[model samples]
Target: MDAITQNLDLFWNGFLRSLTICLWGGVGSLVLGTFIATCRVAPVAPLRTFGTAWVTVIRNCPLSVLLFMFAFGLPEIGINAEYYYFGLAALIIYTSAFVCEGLRAGINSVSAGQAEAARAIGLTFTQTLTQIVLPQAFRTSIPPVGSVIIAMFKNSAVVGAFGVGLDLYSVGESLTSAQGFAALPVLTGVAIGYLMITLPAGVGLGVLERKVAIAR
Candidate 1:
């Protein structure tokens, strides 16, 4: 217990840093993913192709390779990581592909008849999508989306390899080396941290879904 306590104190700043990385990365992915997914649904053929290609490339690549490329490749071009921007950039790109697929499934699940009905009521396709389709689609996608967000949060641990020194996974690794304990304690902390964020998000999304359903 004392060993764990000592390690906890040693790793506090790292945990806090990791929290920031995960929170921002997950939310950033959600916003950008939603936008790209919307573009894929656009009537324009080029946009659909572009969005599809974007998802394909990122989804097919492993996260570690993508992070390594972003960390090393950008600096060669002068976008240096003196600002920690590279880690965030990598995370956003890595997670966005997943979020895009999740949202695409959600949007597709929205019945075709609903969009047709919305259009019949004098709503433009854009209006119907924004006002009617999205809300319902989001509700339907909440479970899967929440899961993706949690995955993104866990993946944020990968940023430590790019020299984001203070994140949770980094801290855990540091502690394990410094304290010489088994991996159980460090992994336990990481698991708890993930559940702490994701469980509440899942519950809240569930509540929101029920509220929307009731309103309808």
Candidate 2:
């Protein structure tokens, strides 16, 4: 309590940074994942191959390794950016693979007959996917996609260790190491900070899931 009370500003800043990471990371993953999911289901064989390869390689790689690559390897290739962007990039790339898979599963859940019906009505593959498939797919995919986002929120803690030190985990580290605060209270504060983000998100997802289920 004393640790948190004494360092309220630090904790608040960390919370905001973590929230920012999650916001951008979540949006990036969803957009990129949706594109990849579309490619995986497209008529073009090359697109399908690329999608498969992306999911395979990225899903298999460890997040830490990806972070190291984004944090260090990007600079080596003359793509200099702030550590914050690098951390966000790593989170976006890693989480997007799982997001792609979740959406692909939702796409598969969509009835094939609807797509065929659209095709028979002179609709192109893009039109059928965009108009007929993706809408229903997104509704059905809310659960898994929500879960992935929550996991990504938790995973954002790892970003602090990789040099994005303005997050909750890093704040706790700073309090304990630099300010001589006890590790226990500092860690408790960090956990609460994360919970403040994830708990509400979880509840909101549950409500959304129920609503989608009712709609279905």
Candidate 3:
């Protein structure tokens, strides 16, 4: 109990940092994801092929490896190390690929006639996609998108692997190193912190899916 009280600040800071990374990755990836998904499903075969390759390669590659490559490898190529952004960049690349597929699936769920109707109403392809297609697709895709959000949320811990300061997993390691006596309790606290981020979003996503289904 004393140990728990003593280390609350450390746990709080680390969890917040981890969460910040997740939030950035989640939102950043979605923007890029929508664009990539749209282009992948474009009539142009070359765009489709390139997008497909991007998604496939990122999905298959282990995230830790991606982190290693970006954090260490980029500097060797004259890109230099900016720790937070490197993690953020890798995360954006990784999660965008996934969110691309998720959004693509959601876009496909919308009927082609809806887009045709939007075009009939004087909306350009971009406007039709933004106003008509994506809005509804977002509702339908709540679960999948939520899953990706949570995944990015959890996987942000991987950023700690590259020695970024004060993220949750790294903090856990630091705590273990600092207080050899309280390692179990410290890690358990970290686990709970992660659940706090993950579980609520998951439940909210379930509610969203149900609401969308009922309205349909």
TM-score of each: 0.83, 0.91, 0.88
Q: Positional deviation of 109 in candidate 3, in angstroms? A: 1.1
**Number of the candidate with higher TM-score, 1 or 3:** 3
The positional error of residue 34 in candidate 3, measured at the CA in angstroms, is 1.6
lDDT of 1 by residue, 98-212 (tens): 8888888888888889889999999997899799888888877776777787777777777775567767676667667765767887768766765776788778877766765
Among residues 3 or more apart in sequence or in different chains, the pairs in candidate 2 whose N, CA or C atoms overlap within 3 Å are: none
Q: Write the per-residue lDDT of candidate 3 for residues 67-144, one digit (tens) a residue.
A: 888888999989986788898889889999999999888878899898999999899988997899889888777778
Best by TM-score: 2
Clashing residue pairs in candidate 3 are none
lDDT of candidate 3 at residue 197, scale 0 to 100: 81
Output the lDDT of residue 13, model 1.
70
Q: Mark the regions of model 2 whose C-alpha exceeds 4 Å error after superposition.
A: 116-131, 214-216
Look at candidate 2 and tell me the lDDT of residue 75: 89
Local accuracy of candidate 2 as per-residue lDDT tens digits, 48-165: 9999999999999999999999988998989999988999999999999999999988888888898999999999988997999888888889999999999998999999877688
Over 4 Å off in model 1, which ranges? 124-127, 179-187, 198-216
Greater-lDDT candidate between 2 and 3: 2
